[model samples]
Target chain A: MSPKTACFLVIGNEVLSGRTRDSNTQTLAHALNAQGIILSEVRVIPDIPQRIIDAVTECRARFDMVFTSGGIGPTHDDITTACVAEAFGVALRCHQESYDALNALFPEEAFNQARQKMAWLPEGSTPIKNTVSTAPGFSIGNVHVMAGVPSIFRAMVQWLVPQLEAGAPLTMCSWHAFNVYEGTFAEALTTLQGDFKTIDLGSYPFARDDKHGVALVAKGYDSHAVQEAGRALKSLLTQIGVTPISGEPAP
Target chain B: MSPKTACFLVIGNEVLSGRTRDSNTQTLAHALNAQGIILSEVRVIPDIPQRIIDAVTECRARFDMVFTSGGIGPTHDDITTACVAEAFGVALRCHQESYDALNALFPEEAFNQARQKMAWLPEGSTPIKNTVSTAPGFSIGNVHVMAGVPSIFRAMVQWLVPQLEAGAPLTMCSWHAFNVYEGTFAEALTTLQGDFKTIDLGSYPFARDDKHGVALVAKGYDSHAVQEAGRALKSLLTQIGVTPISGEPAP
Candidate 1:
C-alpha cells in the first residue's frame, strides 16, 4: 500500500539567520513517519510574504498534507497567517473560539491589538487548540499551520496527529557491521534492493571509536517483506565476514 | 548594500525518514551569515532523482549561490552527481584529481567499482577538497555539493567559505526584559520597526525559571543602525516598567 505524503514548512527569519535551530522538522518527521505519512520534503523558509505564500500554495498542491511551523506568534514579524490567507485567496475573519480562549488568558487591556491579531485567522479554517498559549493554530483544507516554538509545536502535533486519518504503520529494521566500508559492500546492497523491489533500502556509513561501519536499513509497509530484507541484510553482512548487529550502530 | 542570497538543499532519505538529524543546515546557516550571505531558503529533500534535479535547477537560478549536502556517496542511493549533471544538461565526467585522491587511499584491488563511482562528477565542475574523506565534493555553477557527515561537511564548509567572495558582516544586538508579554509590547515593536526602517527587528519569547520574557533583536549590515535599534528596544522595556537585560536571556 502506498503511504500518504506530507511536506513540512518551517517559516522563521531567526532560523534563516542562524539565531534559532529548527527542531520542529525532526519532530514532524518522526510524527509523520509513525503515522505512515511519509515526510517527502521539508523547507525552512524566511518570514517573507511571497516566499511563504509560494511554498504554501506549491506544497499543498504537491503533497497529501502540508504542515507549517512558526510565524504564527503575536509579533510584527508574524505574517504567516495573513500570507496563508492570501495563498488560499480567503479573507481574514474573527475566529470566535480562539478569540475567547485568548481573551480569557489576559485582562481586557492586556489583550491589545497584537493579541487580537491572533484571533484573525483564514476564513473557514478549523482551529487547532493550543494549551501552551491561548492563541490557537488553524487548519484550512490540507494545510495545518502551527506554532514555531518547540514546546508549542510539539503540543500541537500531539493534538493533531491522533486526529489524522490513521494509516498502516511502516515496518523498519536495520543491520550494522563494524569495519565494513560502504564502497566495499555497495554492490551487494544495490542487488539486495533489486531483490526486494518494493522495500526502501539504504546504507549509511558511520565512524565510531576509530572504527567504521555501514548501517543498512529496510523499510516498507509490508512487515513480512521488511523482515525478509532484514535477514537478507544480515546474511550479506555474514557473507562479507563481519558480525551483524540487529539494530543501528551505537552512537 | 544587499547581501548575496543563498539556498541550502539537504538531499537524503535518511533525514526525511527520521533516521538522521540534519546538523548541516545550522552549520551552513552560521557560515553563510558570517559571510554576509543571507540563507533565504532550505530544503531537506529525499534521495529521489527528479526531486534533486528539479531543486538544483530551480534554486541555482533563483539564488546567488546554492549549497547541497548528502547523496554524493558511492552507494547506489547516492545519485546526486548524475542528477545534478542532468539538471544542467551536462554529462558525468571523470574528475581526475578526485579519482587520483581516492585511488591513493586504497590498495589496487580494494579500490573496486563501487569506490570508483565516487570519482565521477558533473562535467565542468571544480572539486571541493574533503579533508575527512579521500573522496571530494564538487561545485557546478552556483551550487556547491558536500558530504552529509557532520565532520566532513564542516571541513568542506571551512574550505569552501574562505574561498568565496567575502562581504560585510552583519551587526546584531539584543535586549530582553523579564515579565514582558509579547502582545503588550507588539505595538511598540511595530512602531520601532517602522522607525528603524532598514534594520530587521524581531522579538522572541522565552520562559526561564518560571518567568517569561521577550528578547528583541536588531540585525543588519549597518552596525550603527543595529546599535541604535538596540537602545530603542531598551527604552521600550524601560517605558513598560521592566528592567532591560542586554543580550539574550539566560537559559
Candidate 2:
C-alpha cells in the first residue's frame, strides 16, 4: 500500500505578493520525507478568510494530515486561527493553560489585546510546543496550525513529524557526470525506469559557471533495487566517456 | 475595481521530493505584480498526469490567466506537453517551424528521438520565445507553459507578461525602524490600516545580528494613498522612539 498523504497550506499575503520567498515548504518536505509520509500537494494562498477556510477544509478531508503555516501571529493581518476554526465549524476559545502560561511571560500591562490573542485557539485544540516564541502552535483534529516564522514552523515540524504514523522511508542513490548532455542518455534513462518497477529514476541537468552535467537519481522504498540502479547509472556515465561521481554534482 | 487575477502551477517531482528549491513562483509573482495582475494562488504538485490535468483545468476556469512551470523537456519524465493536451482535449501536433528550428541546431546523427520530442505542442498553441534554450514554450488559451529552469522561466515570463492585458501596476511605499516590536505597535498599526482606505498596509518584523525591527509597507494601485501611508508609517515609528529608515531594512 502507498504511504499516508500530507498536504501543506502556506497561508499569507507575503508569499502571494512576492514580498517573501518561502522556506517552510522545503522544510516540511524534508521532515515529512523522514517520517515516510507522502507530501502530495502544497498550496500558497493570501490571508483571506474564505481562501483559508476553503483550503483548510478541503485538504483536511482529502489528505491523511494537513499542515498550515503563516498568519497565526498576534496582529491584525493574522487571521489563520479564526479561519481554521471556521473551517471546522468550531468557535475560538481561550485555553486556560495556554493563556496562563503566555500571560506569565509578560509583566503587568505589557500583555496587550494583541498578545492575548495568541493564547486563543479552536475549541478542543491541543497546543504544540513552541521553543522559539512564547505562543504555542495548536493542532485541531488532523489540521496542524503553526507560526509563519521559518524557525518556529521548522521546530513544530520536527516535533510533530515523529508523532504521526510512518510508512516505508524513501531512499535514494545518485551519480553525476560532467560535460554530458541529458538528451544523449534520455533513452537509457527511460529504459532504466522501465526496468526498475519500484524505482523512480530521474535525470536532472545542472550548469555551473562553465561546467554542465546531469545527475541520475534512483529513489524508491526498496534500498537494494535503488543501489543496483545507482551502479547502472555510473556504468552508463562511464560508457559516455565521462568520469562519474558517486553522488550529486558539485556546485 | 479588483485587478485581473492569476494563478501559478509549479509542476515537478523534484520540487515535491525536496530535491530542488523552486524560484519560478517568485519570478512569476514579481512579473505579474508589474503587469498589475493579482497573483491569487500558487500550487506545487508532483509530475503526475491526473494532478496536472486537474490543476490545469481547474485553474484555467477559476483565474483570468494561469502559468505552469517545469516538466517540459526531452526526457521521459517530461510529460507536461501530453498532459496539457489531455487537459484541453486536443491532439499533440508537431509545429513545423519549431521542429525545423530545433532540428537545425543539432547535426543529423545527434538529433535523436528524445531531442525531437521538444517540438511537439498542443494543437493551435502559440510558441513563446525561450532565449536560454532552443525548445520554445507554448501558450494554449489562457494557460502558458514554460520551462522549470530558473533562467528559462524568468525569460519566458518577461516575454509573456507584456503580451497579456495591462492592469493598474502595483506600487509600494515602505519604511522600517530598528528595535521596534510588531506586537507592541499592533494596535496602532491596526488603526493605521483602518485609516488607509485605498492602500493595503502590512507590518513585517525582522531580526538580524541582535537587532529587531518592523517594516511597515503601504501598497496599492493608488500611488498617492501609498505615499501618504508611508509618511504616517514614518511618524508612527518616530512616535515610538525609534529611528525610521526609508524602504526595506538592510539585510
Candidate 3:
C-alpha cells in the first residue's frame, strides 16, 4: 500500500515572532515516520483565524492526516479550536464529557471561565486524552488539534497514533564520504539515481569538527533496493578515491 | 518603521522524509530577528515544482522578502531555481557571471552537465556569492535562493543581510517562575497583556532539570515597554508565591 501522507501545522504567534522555537514539528515528523506515515509538509503559522482555517482546510484535503500543535490553551491567543470548527463548517460546542473531566481534575476554586475554555471542541469530533494534562485535544475528520505544550502534545500523539492506519515503513542506508565535495560526485550520484528510480537519494553536506563531508542517503519502501543503492553510492565514492564510511560523519 | 516581514521556504524531500532535520529555519529565524526583520512563516515543503512555485509566489507577495533554502544543488532533485523562476513569471537564464565563476573553480575534466546546472537562474536576478562553494545562489524579485548547507546558507545570508533595509530591532525579556503553572498566572498575564498593547506576551510550559514551570516572555519594538512588561510579569509571579528567574530556566 502507498504510504499515508500527513502534514503538521504549528500555530503560534510566538513561533513566528521568534520568541518560541517550535520543536513540535520535529517531534511529529519523527513520530509519524516511525509509524509509517509520510509527513510531507510542516508549516509554522501564526494565531490568525483566517490563516488557521485556510491551512487546516487545505491540508486536510491535500494529505491523509493533519496534526496541529498550539493555540488550544485558555488564553485570548488560543483560537485554534474555533478556527478549526469554522474550517470544517462545524459549530463549536462545549463537550460535556470534557467539561466533567476537567471539573474533576481541578479544584473547584481553580475551575473558572478560563479553564472552561478547554472543554470547547468542534461538533462531531472525539477527544484525544492528554495524560500530561487533564484538558483533552480533539480529532475532527482528518485534523487532530493538540495542546502547544510539548509534554501534552506528545502524550496526546502517543495515545492517538496506534488507532490510525499505518503504511509500510521506509528502509534507509547511508554512506558518509569524508573530504568529499558534492561537485566531485554530482555526476555519479545523478547516474545512480537514474539507475535506481525507486530509491530516493539525498546528499547532505556538513562542515563540522573542522572537517567537511557529504552524507549520501538512500531510502525506499524496499529494503533490498535501499541497500543496493547504498552499495552503489559507496562504490562511486571509492572510484573517486574517497573512502566511504557507513553512517553519518562525526560532528 | 515597522519590521519588514519575511517567510522562509525550505524545499527538500529529505527533510519531509525525516532523513534530515532542518536547522536552516531556526538559523534564518534568529538571523532575521537580529536584523530586525519579522519572519512570519516557515514552510518545509517537498521538491515538487508546483508546491515550491506556489509557496514562493504566495510568500513573496505576502511578505517584504522570501528566503528559500535547498533544492539548488547539482542533481535531478535540484529544481528550486527553476521553480522560483516560474513563480516570478520569468525564464531560467544561464547566468553568465556564475557560469564563468563555476568554470574557473572546477577542473576542465570535472566540469560536467550536472555541475553546470548550478549556473541557471531566473532572468533579472543577481547572484549571491557562496564562499563555501563555487555555485552561486541568486535573488529575483523579493526572493533569495540559498544553499541548503548550514555553513553556506549562513554565509550567503551574512553577505546579503547588509544590503537589505532592516526594521526596528525588537527588545525582549523573560521570566521563569519555578513551580508556576499557566493557570496560576493566567488572569494576571491577561491583565498585563491588556496594559501593554504593543508588546507580545508568550507563556511557555517547560519541563527540564527535574522541574516543571512556565516561562513568560514579553517582547516589543519599544525597549521601555518590554522592560515594563517584564517587571510586571515578575511582580505577578511573586504575588502568586513563586520567585521568577530573570531568564530562561536551566535545561
| List of clashing residue pairs for candidate 1 | none
Q: Docking category for candidate 3?
A: medium
Ten-residue region with minimum lDDT total, candidate 2 chain B: B204-213
Give the residue spans of candidate 2 off by over 4 A. none
lDDT of each: 0.89, 0.87, 0.85
Query: Looking at every candidate separately, what fraction of the true A–B Cα contacts under 8 Å does it contain?
Result: 0.68, 0.58, 0.48
Residue by residue across A84-124, what tens digits does model 2's lDDT show?
Answer: 99999999999888889878988768789998899999998
TM-score quality measure for candidate 1: 0.96
Off by over 4 Å in 3: none
Cα lDDT for residue A73, candidate 2:
80
State the lDDT of candidate 2 residue by residue for B91-175, as single tens digits.
9999888889888888888788898899999998999898877788999999999988787888899999988988899888889
lDDT of 1 at B236: 92
Residue A164 of model 3 has an lDDT of 86
DockQ-derived CAPRI band for the predicted complex in model 1: medium
Interface quality of candidate 2 as DockQ = 0.71
Between candidates 1 and 3, the one scoring higher on DockQ is 1
Candidate 1 interface RMSD to the true structure? 1.3
Please, what is the TM-score per model? 0.96, 0.97, 0.94
Please give the lDDT score at residue B187 for candidate 1: 90
TM-score of chain B of each: 0.94, 0.97, 0.95
lDDT of 1 at A120: 97
User: The CA-based lDDT of model 1 is what?
Assistant: 0.89
